[model samples]
Target: MRAAVVGAGPAGMVAADRLASGGAEVVVLEATGAVGGRTRSVLLGPGHRLDTGASWLAGFYSEALAYCSGLAMLRRDVTGTPQLVVGGRRYPAPFEPGVLARSPLLGPTEKLRFARWVAGVLARRRRPHVGPPRRADADRADRIDADTAIREAVGAAAAEYVLRPAFETMVFADLADLSAAFVEGWIRAAFDGRYRVPAEGMDAPWRRLAARLEVRCGVEVTEVRPQGPGGGVVVEPVGTFDAAVVAVPAPVAARIVPPGVPGRPAWLGELRHAPHVLAYAARPHPDPPPASDVHPAGAGRHRVGSVALYPGGDGRVPVGMQGATVSAEGWWSDELLAAGLDDRALAAALWDEGRRLEPGLFGLEEATVLHVARHPHAVPVFGPGHLARLAAWSPCPPVALAGDWTCYPCVEGAVRSGRRAAEVLLTAGR
Candidate 1:
C-alpha cells in the first residue's frame, strides 16, 4: 500500500511513521522548509538555542514520551514553588499544597468554598485520554464553560484569582472560552507532577521521527481529493495513494480538502484558535533568579501574560546569564497582529511589560531580545460543544483527518490523533 501524509507537524510525522510501520510505503509532505510545526526551536546565538513553541512535556503525554524514549531528557524540578503575581503581590500558586489555607488571595469563607469545589472535581477525576471523554459524567462536563462552572461552584474571587490565570497561562485562551471537561482532564493529567523537555530542544523528537521516514520538506500540498472510489490523489504536482492523512490545522484542512470528501465536516471551519507571541531574551544575572515560572492573575491588565525563566547552567545561555521567554496575553497578541507590528517592535513591547511587571525577576533592564515567535493558531480552543462535534464525526476509509484539533490540544493529543488516523486506513485494508 502507498500512503501520503500532508503537513510535517507532530500529527503528520507520527501518522507517516505509523503507516510505514504498518507495511505501507509513505511519503510526508511539508509546506515549510522545516518540520515540527508549532514545536519549533530557533537559534538565539552562537551556543544558544531556545524553543519558541511547545516547550514542556507533562507526565501524562504518554505518546509523546514514548516517541522521545531514547532521547536525552531534562526534568524541570517543580520543588521550587511557582508564584502567582496579582495586584503587585506574589502568592503561592493555587495548586501548591497548603496554599489555599495560607494564601491571602482568598478570604476564610471563600477558601472553604473553593476547597469544596476542588474536592468535587477531584472526586470525579479520571485518567486523561485523547479525543472526547467516553464516560457519561465527563461528557456532561464538556457542555459547560469553565468560567461559568468555576464561578457557580466556588465564587467570583476563586474563578478570577485562582483558576482563570492558571488555565489561561497553559492554553493561552480565556477560561470563559474553554470547556470544563478540558480543565478537569488537565487537572487529572498534570497531577503526576512530572514535567520535562528534550535536552536538545522541543523539536528533537519530531526531527528524530522524520529522519526515519521519507519526509519531503518545502513541498506544499495544495489539495487532497478523492480519486475513484477507494483511493485519494494529492494535487499540485499530483500523487495518487491508497490512503492519505490530512494532519494540518483545522482551518488549513478546510482549505485543502475540497468538497465531496466523505470525512470533511462543516465544523472544521468553525474551530477557534488562540494567537500567541513569545519573546525570547537573555540577560546577565549575578544574583539568584526569581521564580522560574510566573502566572499573572488578571493577565489582561498586564501586557505580558506569563514568564518562564530558564534554570542556571541550562546551556541555553552563556555562564552568568539567564534566559527567559515572555508570552503576551492572548488579547494583546491579537492587537499586535492586527497592527502588523514587526518582530522588533513586538519584542520591545514585551520587554517593557516584563520590566514594569517584574523588575527583579530577570533583570529585564539589561536583557537583549534574541527572537520573537508568533503563532496565529497557537492552540485549538476546546469550548463547549467541541467534544460533541468531534464525537459525531466518522472517518471514511483512505481519507482520514489528524490533528490536535481532532483530539485535545496538546502534544499527546496530536500524536494520538495521528496514530488513530493511520489505524483507520490500515484496518480498512486500504
Candidate 2:
C-alpha cells in the first residue's frame, strides 16, 4: 500500500517512518525546504548551530525520549535549578528542594501552602473531566478533555512559583488559555525531576527519522481530495495514495481537508495558532550579569545562566539559546532589554560571565549568528475544553491526523499522537 504523510514535523516524520518500516511505501511531504517542522535548527555560522524552533526536551516527554533513543540521539544535561523571580523578590523554584533551599519571594507559610498543593496534585493522576461533568453527544462530536486552569488548581502561591514561569515560557500567553490537566500532568512528570537536551539539537533525531523514510522537501500540498472509488487520497504533486495521514499543523490541515466526509475521517476546521519569535546572536564575550542585582528591579533571572550556549573562546557568547518568552505584543523584548540583553551585548555578556554559569566561566568570540525565524503560531495552546474539540475532530478510515497540536502541544505529545495515528492505520491494515 502507498501512504502519503503530510507536513514534515515530528508527528508527520514519525508516522512516515512507522508506515515505511511497516512495509508500506511512504512518501513524506513538507512545505518548508527542510523537515522537522517546528523543531528545526538554523545555521548560525559556518559550524555554529541554533535551534530556530523547538528547544527543550525533558524525561517527562516519554514518547519523544523513546523515539530519540530509538534513533540513537545523544543528549546532555541542560536543566538548571534556578531561583524564581517574582514581582521584585527571589524565591526557590516551586519544587521542594528549591522551595526549602532559599527564597525571598515566599514566606514560610506561603511556601508550605505551595508545597501542600503540589503534593496533593502529585498524589492524584486521575485527570479531572471537564465540561458538563458527563460526556454529551456534542462532546464526542467535538473534542473533549480535562478543563481547568493551573492557577485555579495550584492556588496563587504554587501558581506563582510553577505555573507562572511555565506559562511564561511555554504558553507565552495568559494562563486563562492553558489547560490545567495538561499542566498538572507535566508537573507530575517533572516531580521525577529530570530535563535534558540533545547534544546535536532536536533536528538530529528528526534527521535520523528522515534517514529511514523517503522525504520530499519544499513540496507544497495544496489540497487532498478523496478518490471517489477506493479508500485513497489524491495528493497534489504526488498523484494518489491508497491511504494518507494528515500531519500538518491545524491551520494547514484545515486548508487541505474538507470539513465533513460522512463516511471518511475528517479533522475539524483550523485549530488556533499562537505567535512566537525565535532569534539568535553571537558575541565576542560572555553576556554580562544583569545591570540590576535584584531579581525584578535589576536583571531578569530568566536569562542569565538559563539559556543554552556552546563553550569555547575569547569570552564570546551566543544569545540564541536563552529561550526568552515573547508575549502576544512582543513585550518580552522590553524585559530582555531591561535585563541587559541585546543580540550583540547579550552574547558579549555571556562571554564575560564565562561560557558556563559557574565562577570564571569561559566565553566565545564573535561567534557568527546565522539567522532566526519567527513561528507566528508555533506551539498550540492546549486550552480548557480542548479535549472535547479533539474528539469532535476525529478522523475516519484512510485518513488519520497527528501532530503536537493534536495532543498536548509538546514534543512528546506530537510523537505520541503520530504513534497513535500510525497504530490506527496499522490496525486497519492500511
Candidate 3:
C-alpha cells in the first residue's frame, strides 16, 4: 500500500515514518524549502545557526525523547534564577525555595494565597469524576475564561506580576477569551518542572527523521482531494495513496483539504493559530549573572515581555556556544504582527526594548549578527469550548488528521496525534 503524509512537521514526519516502517511506500510533502515546519533553525552568520522556533525539547516530551534516543540534550537553568529589574532596581526572582517569603515580586500573604489557589486548581483539575458526574457533569471549570480564573484565584496583583508575564512569553492570549481548562492543563505541564533543548537547534531531531524518510521539500500542495470512483486519496498531482495523513496547521489544513472530505473535521476551518515574532542573535561573552530564560517585571519597561538565552551557543557561531537569543513580548510583538511591518523596523524596536532590560543581553558588546523569524500561525490557541469541539470528533477514514492542535498543544500531543493517524491507516488494511 502507498501512503501520503502532507506537511513535513513533527506530526507529518511521524506519520510518514510510521507508515514506512509498517511496509507501506510513503511520500512526505513539504511546502517550505525545509521539513521542520515551526521546528526550524535560521542562520545569523556563516556557520551560525539558531533555533528561532519551537526552542525547547522539554523533559515531559516522551515522544521526542523516545524518538531521538541518542541525540544529545542540553539544559540551561535560566528561569530558575531569573533577574527582574523594576524601576532600575534588580531583584532576584527565582522559582525556588522561600521566594514568596523573601522576594519582592509579591507580598507574603498574597504569595501564600496564590500558591494555595494553584494547589486547589490543580486538585480540582485532577479530581476524578464519580459515576453520573462523568456522564452528565457540567463543569464550570471548563467553561470559565482563564483570565477570570487567574484573577479570582490568585488575585489581580499576583496574576499581573507573575502569571501574565509567563503566559505572554509562551504566547500572547486575551485570557478573557481563552479557556480555563486549557490554561490549567498547560500550567499543570509546567508543574513537572523540566526543560531540555537539542544540542543542535530545534530542527535537530526532525532533520534526522527527514533524512531517513522519503521527504519531498519545496513542493506546494495546493489541494488534497479523494480520487472519485477510484477509492483512494489523490494528493493533487503528487500521486494516489491507499491512505493519507493531513498534519498541517489547522488553518492551512482547512484550505488544502476540500470541504466535506471524509475524515476532515469542519472545526479545522473555524480555528485560528497564534502569531509569534522572535529575534535571535550571537554574542561572545557569558551573559553577566542571570541569563537562562529571564522574564523582567516589565514594570518600568513594558515592551520587553520576557527574554531568553540558550545556555550553550550553537557551536557554529563565533561566540562558540556562549551566544544568546532575545525576544520581545506583550505589545511589542502583538502591535506589528500580521500588519506588514518591515523586518528592520520590527527587529530594531524589539532590540531597543531588550537592550534596556539587560545591558548584558547583547553579551560583551552589541550583537554581531541578528536574525528575526515571524510565525503567523505559530501556536494553536485552545479557547473556550475548543475541547468540547474536540470531544465530538470522529474520523471519516482513508484520510486521518493529526497535529499538536488535534490534542493538547504540546510536543507529546503532536507525536501522539501522528502515531494515531498512522494507526488509523494501518487499521484500515486498504
- Clashes counted in candidate 3 amount to 3
lDDT of 3 by residue, 138-169 (tens): 55666778888888887876666766666656
List TM-scores for all candidates, in order.
Answer: 0.93, 0.74, 0.87
Cα displacement (angstroms), candidate 1, residue 234, comes to: 2.7
Q: Which digits, one per residue and each the tens of the lDDT, describe model 1 over residues 1-430?
A: 7888998888999999998999989999898898899888877666577887888888778899999999888786564345778877878766654877888888898898887877777777756566776643447878999889888888888887878766686778888998888887786665667888887788889999888899898988888887876545654555788778999888888888886787888788889789889888787666545436777775245557777776447755656678877888778888888878887788878877876666555544577646889888889999988887887775666679999999879888899988988889899874
lDDT of 2 by residue, 38-60 (tens): 88876544445566777667766
* Clashing residue pairs for model 3: 78-292, 263-396, 313-321
How high is the CA lDDT of each candidate model? 0.79, 0.58, 0.70
Per-candidate clash tally: 0, 41, 3
Candidate 1, residue 389: the lDDT equals: 80
Rank candidates, lDDT, best first: 1, 3, 2
Better of 1 and 3 by TM-score: 1
The TM-score of candidate 2 is 0.74
